[model samples]
Target chain A: MTENKAFCSRCGVEVEPHKATCPLCGTSIQQTEEEEPTSYVKKYPDEPAVKTEKTGRTAKQKRIFIWEVVSVTLLIPLLITLFVDLIVNKTVTWSLYPISSLILAWFLISTPLLFPNILPLLYIGETLPPAIFLLVIDKIEDGQINWFLDVGLPIEAVVAVIAAIVIIGSIKIKNKGMNIAAFILFGAGLICLGIDFIVLKHTRGTFGVSWSLYVLTSTAVIGGFLLYLHYRLMKNTKLQRKLQI
Target chain B: MNSSNFPTKKTDEESNQNHIQKAPKKDWFRLDNAATVFSFVTSTRIPCMFRFYANLKKPINVAILQQALENIIDRFPYYKVNLRNGLFWSYWETNPGMPVVIEETKYPCQKMPIRKKGIFPFRVRAYYNRISVEFHHSITDGTGALIFLKSLVGEYLTLIGVVVNDWQDVFRPNQEPHYEEYEDAFKKNYQKNLPGPPRVSKAFHLPFKLEPKGVFHLTIGIMPIKQILNKSKELDVTLTEYLVAVYLEALQDILFSLPLRKQKRLLKPIRLQVPVNLRRFFSSKTMRNFSLYVTPYIDPRLGHFSFDEILKQVYHYMRVEVSDRYISQQIARNVRGELHPLIRLTPLFIKRLFGKIIYNGQGEFLYSGVITNLGKVSLPEPLNKEVENIQFLSAQSPVTKTGCAVNSYGEKLYINFGRIIKEAHVEKLFFRKLVKDGIKVRIETN
Candidate 1:
């Protein structure tokens, strides 16, 4: 053991007996021909025990199992509807509506259950299913895509945009008390104006606004008052004391 | 509740049966001022945990250690609670489930599942001759943890037929915990109208990439206490002062060694967050977080500093900043923030978001590194003789990249560095400097 003493020429610190490489600098320690190699006893065990808690099922496994069960449950209704449609009509006819509606329902419910934490996918899940359902209904009724594009898609886009702003704004804002309510009020006003514009252009063949003007005016006043209360009055501690509820 | 509420004596069979029984319903505690922040910032990458262990002369008997843990756990009831979320703050609820002793892991301070219902905030593990306890910072500071470790070691020794007559500072298993032990010392000692400590500028951080999540690197350097003590004495400074200067000097070396352009870009002060245990200054036995930090720094942009200059700066800074007046200012600031009407009215989820922002902006971001010294550990009589050495390992910080914990047992001082980055530059420079300063260091890594 005494002959196994070795030092790293680079670091000048004595390593453990018979270590080929320095633990600090990873420099190779040269061994002498006359010295015998010695096995170093480790202070701590090298292999880590896999840290796991004993439970009946893990959270991820449970989620996956629930997703599988829901998928199978939805599959039963879809298979039954298609079988009934085939048995009734020689080819495919009115079964298209139920089939499409069931498929849309399955997509809408399953996206949130399976990928609940993914934000982008959730937004798509919220917007895409309704858009597809509207398009299918429009085609089955009029045999052309007229109201779906002009009315349904535009309204869905407006709602999605406004909802995205409110959700993302609430999450990113530092002090989330009255400011979140203000954001929602502002979003509500924007959605009203958007709906009025789209419906006027689709129905009257002219882009104009009417009743939504009254709704927008009321929401803007309330939203503006809330913003003023949050940024101005709420910041004054003396005022807060006097106005304590 | 006082000592009378706890049953002191039980038969061996009864004690064994009571090991896993439901904890009696006790009044829950609000998370201490310092602990509230730890709860917000704890994650898989930064566990916000620390470990204190004693190495025995012989290999550990697992069954005896487990029995010893089960016997003594009821004494430290404050540590046996689980973290519970509240409307405006998080509190500790007494957990009915028992905390079991398990085998030690290769990594020292892995994350504890404190957010889970019924899980305790601390764990005890045994590996070979070493018995270790890892505590979440939300539960207690080093002083509190050391007492628990001493009590556990004492009970373990007594079970294995060792007579420990000197029970000086160690809490025996049969003793009921004092009411004072459950007090939040920071709030108790907080002064109402003191000025808060000045805000610090952002210090230079290590530019190394972070390691994969859950991978922590620990390197321990064991040296003779007398040698380092003599060196500090020769320099006319305390052990902590000497070590902090060495750390700053190492950072300076790494700073100046970079390319000129990079060095210019990274010309910030090198500061270390040194935790000062408040129980020393304030008279309290609260087993929760009761410590704050004083940052001793050297601005490299001023000029190149010799080791003597660095040592003088650290010595003076620590002398002035670690006093009762200065420490009280920090406590005042923390308690005041918690007491503010706006902050108190905000919900816990909002506070958590604000905590993340503050932790990123002002927490570890303001310090280059941390060095926590538990000072010297002393156990009673024959138990001390059976214990070979004691080690303290600080938690891994993803932002700071490295942290150092120092403690001494018997003749040896163990300086353990816990890192979460792939680079070992800080550890290499620190130990190599000590070796150059005429201290013999034996290196151990995990």
Candidate 2:
């Protein structure tokens, strides 16, 4: 059996059958007559000439398809409600609010899903639907863009701008803390104060913050406490381990 | 049954039994000059991969293939090494165990993360009778890769009770690996006095738009080598030179067809890179990357070149550039840079930055596209009788939207055109031209 075995000319190691070159040195393998013979037959039938075409949807297209399915699912319930409201009231009375709000809600939810990669654009883009919904409601029942222009647009613009800033800042910084949550809380509080001032000024001759002061005080205390906890967590390794799964 | 569906336990135990005690100890080796450029540029989307598939006579037995893979792991230890990031250059550390064999997926050559912890640089996938190995370019050149594939196939056939002739010529299990197989041949053959190869100003690019999803498509056109050889004899050039001439002629048509203004802006000389295996030139037996490329250029500005004219020019250029001294100068330029004191001292991050710059400014831009011919693959009589066909496909990158690779087995020459672009016009043109010259081509795509 040992005499029947052949070896590689370059490496002096026994070579396997059917290899054209030595696997170790890559030299052209030398052939010899010494080998055991046995019966080996082809058992499986030949494969037909075939090619698999790439017809499946891309990842981006798949996401868009899911969005369409969700949108259609939501739209069906709103349509049923609209018919019920018409049968009861016999006029476009209560359905107007639900119809307008549902459309606004769908737009806000889908816009983020539609352009998920552009974070800043999503923050700013979500503001349009709410303002448009308000204007549409004002036109259907009464005929005024006054509420939209004075309060709706301004409030939406301020929030969208602040949200965009926070998102863009978070992406730029590597070491994120709980500062982002605190920043958003302070921004929302400031927006609320501005909203109170706007309402007071519109109804009366003077502008004064009434409801927003209490809201601001609460948010400030909570945000300050969160900042303290975040710093403590960063320093305490044992506690960090205990908090995580 | 689907290819991924296999009997798991039997295969696992057989492979574990064969390879557990004999796994080679850890070994480390430096990357050659040609391989040094690959690590910095590798990414998930654009992995440096070259793959080949063999259509067997019978359906693949995964249990036997896995066991065969484990049996032969000790023979090709250089390929079994994991890439390690060094301070100055990336290196390879011998992985302690055998690489796992997996089923083929929808995508081919999806990134192999050798740089990441505990990852291998090559993949072996089986789909029925088709077994494909996609290797990172850093480990081996085409010749070395072909040898590895042949050895794997040889082992697979033997495990299934196939009578393989000339058994000693192929890689056998339990053979101690040769130390010289890991030597950096480029460093051994480098000369200090040689001059750098001439600089290329600009190379013409294909004007087609890239595919939307960036999916690479491979089209295999199999034809009888006799017809190609006859044509080459008529043209009085080698088969590789004749094929490259046809490729250049196709690019020439695209160049001249553009409108005058667009032509002036985009029309540059077409430089076709042909990779020459250095094992033939230098006497080293190392299997790691030992190859350099020769760029044969055609200046469209000079005048319209007929097919015959292009053939003559390619033949002449290949002859001159493939010589011993000319090839040495090409290797010298790379070895000289590696030997520089400041270059050796630079950190890995800085070296990566320089690698990127060099790849963009000097590496790929010097040529329009690459066409690698592995020449011919030969197996012993009995084993070769059971095989039907073999196909090779080159990897496509951002800079190169398409590339060509050729390998011949038995009577058929498989010309694989790999492209990332949306249009298959160049591929269509290439086949149509071959048919026009009286060669029948059988086309398959994925």
Question: Model 1, A244: alpha-carbon shift in Å?
Answer: 20
Each candidate's TM vs. the true structure? 0.69, 0.62
- Local accuracy of candidate 1 as per-residue lDDT tens digits, B291-365: 898899999999999999999999999888889999899999999988765566556876775676577788888
Of the true contacts between chains A and B, what fraction does model 1 have?
Answer: 0.21
> Which candidate has the highest DockQ of all?
1
DockQ for all candidate structures vs. native = 0.11, 0.01
Worst 10 residues of 2 chain B by lDDT: B1-10
Per-residue lDDT of model 2, residues A1-245, tens digit only:
23333344644434344455643345676557645533332212233332434555534566689889989987987998899998998866778788888888888888766875454567556877776876887677676566676766677666667666655654454333455556667777777887887777767748698999998888888777766765665444433222211
Ten contiguous residues with the weakest lDDT in model 1 chain A: A236-245
- Model 1 achieves a DockQ score of 0.11
TM-score of the A chain in candidate 2: the value is 0.67
lDDT of 2: 0.72
Candidate 1 structure quality by residue, lDDT tens digits, A17-116: 6677877899998875555676654666676444443433433456578878877887787788878888988666777788788788878887866775
Candidate 2 DockQ category?
incorrect
